[model samples]
Target: MSVPVPKGFSELTNLRSLSGFPVHVDMDASNSWCSLQELEPLSQLRDLTLYGIEKVQDSRMAEKAMISSKRHLQYLKLNYSASGHTIGTCGAEAEQQQQQSVTEEILEKLCPPTCLESFILRGGYVGRRLPDWMCAPESADFKSLRYLMMENLPCCTQLPDGLCCLPSLEGLTIKDAPAIKRIGPQFQASSSVAARGSTASTSAPFPKLRNLQLIGLCEWEEWEWNDCEEHMDVETAIAMPCLERLQIKNCKLSCLPPGLASTKRHTLRELYLYELTNLTHVENIPSVVKLDVFDCPELKKLTALDSRLQKIRIVCCTKLEVLEGVPALDSLVLEDPTMDTLPEYLQAVNPRYLKLDCNKKLYESSSSPGSSEWDKISHIGKRDINCIEDSDTSSDGYSEED
Candidate 1:
């Protein structure tokens, strides 16, 4: 796996971008691997990416690379390719430990400069643990990072600590990280230390985050704060206190981070859920203005829909029968709704616009003059039943039902 860097790479002193370097250590003492230290001369690098990091075994050499010297760099991506390796046997396990130890040291040395604004780590790291440098709230100026993405690290049991809490992070996306089961205060410990006992109120994690997405986490079950060892009281905890939008898709998580979930009461404005079959109940969301649920066949009810929730679009949620909290909704859009019966309080929602994306017979019984649904929706000024079209797009289909 030891690949030598081109002999003249260092001579490219003015390189503005460099990527796909494969530096490695060989089993023979006679063989030589290119040292990462060669990159220090590329001072003008604005974007740098390192691929095949698992092959680099000389931790000291990596440490001397001085990646932090590139003050002009704004974007960095690190890749580790462990493609055909298997960790099934004793010998393989030992080798992983050795590789990871050196990898961790190299990563520690390759910390990006404070001016870095975007970072991505795409890997299939099967090592027992990730490098310590991945953890955020580092002594380094990691607060300058605005956009963060971690993808394809399927065996990574936990995400980097406090990643969501970065003071300047505006967009965060985590995909294909199957091992992450929870994201709570435990992950934010490193950054929370300074605020531990101070009574002075501080900004919460995800304070400036506007968009947060979690996808393809197969083992995720809960995001409950009561399950963690955090010292903050839930009633006062302002986690994700400034979040504007959140999306959870293709995950097995039946629940959300309690701290993040609590923010729905006042901070969260929009929520989108898709293909989360195990997610059956959603309650206590009092402030969400736009809520969209799709293809979650197991979801039987919205246990508590906020009274002021302005709009809701439900698609293919076959088991959902109740929408208890939406007593004052302004618009209701349904497509492939499986509920055989509607909530008794349907009249209370009093939606001015009701659009049903079905075969027009959806409310056959209720469409009649004396039916309860007729009485329930008769007050709606705008109602329409359009044939279902695309599943991914919205269907306003607002026709005046005279």
Candidate 2:
């Protein structure tokens, strides 16, 4: 559409920065764009946001705009919102095919220069798959790609195959891909070994990936550890050598992937798992210093907590019956209303802070003068129950602050 610039805004012909150019097609013949052709003159544009991509016309004029030719562009966000006429409508199969074709062509032709440092795909992409160029060929190595985030892509069954091949990539997030039932070999950096710019001696899929977030994957039940059965030998497995922090939220998986659960295999130091109803256990990641579990109803036990763990938070886990072997634990937070009692082992260890944030039933028992719960938790230096606290801070938790 005609994004009316501030009368003379276009006159800043030498401007190095321009932002917020919304593109949308009015379904009713009432409104129309002046064509994406006008953007060709903005030679100095370095950042762009293209919204309402699904609304573009079928003639593919927008594709011919050749966005990738903008050599100086460093950042871009592509937003797509499905139109009224989609796969769910009558005679859907044919209409869906046509739409997918148009979407793929539009994405394929809108290539960004290799200088792009950040890319974001926001909103819904009903197309079942993404265009190939989302992850450029290995020849380019995507040296400047530092961050990538894709969300609301419910119809896409798999992530871009070459996504992690970028040697410079440091952060990644994938959200709300409900149709993705499994994470297969395509996700591992070693799957594209030769293209990783590394010798056959070593392959790092996410060489620089330090932080990762996976959220709202409703149907993802498995993180396939052995996708390439022919090469399933331990030697060919890929590890997250650089990943230090990871978070998984609202997923349908019943267990943690072997890579993220083993400290010997991954470099993860911080982990958070939330709302995973099917998960039954948490264990084996000894490198993690901080661990948090929230709203996971099926998780019944925490086995082999790392000796390096300094802080732990467990909330809303109704069936959690045990926490084993955490000698280095410095702080413990049991905020779940379902926990009627503290673990008996917690009475001996001393920590700087012990927060018991349960409902009135447990909180009252801890507050009663001669109660067993109150006596057991007395060793903790500082105590806060439902926001009320004892000011006696513990030297154990204080000196070991992370």
Q: How do all models score by TM-score?
A: 0.77, 0.84
Q: Which candidate leads in lDDT?
A: 2
Clashing pairs in 1: 305-325
- lDDT tens digits, residues 24-55, model 1? 54555454445566786889999888877665
Model 2: colliding residue pairs: 68-111, 189-205, 352-397
* Cα lDDT computed for each candidate against the true fold: 0.68, 0.70
Q: List where candidate 1 sits over 4 angstroms from the true fold.
A: 1-6, 19-37, 81-92, 95-105, 136-140, 188-203, 226-237, 261-265, 337-348, 359-378, 388-400
- Candidate 2 has what TM-score? 0.84
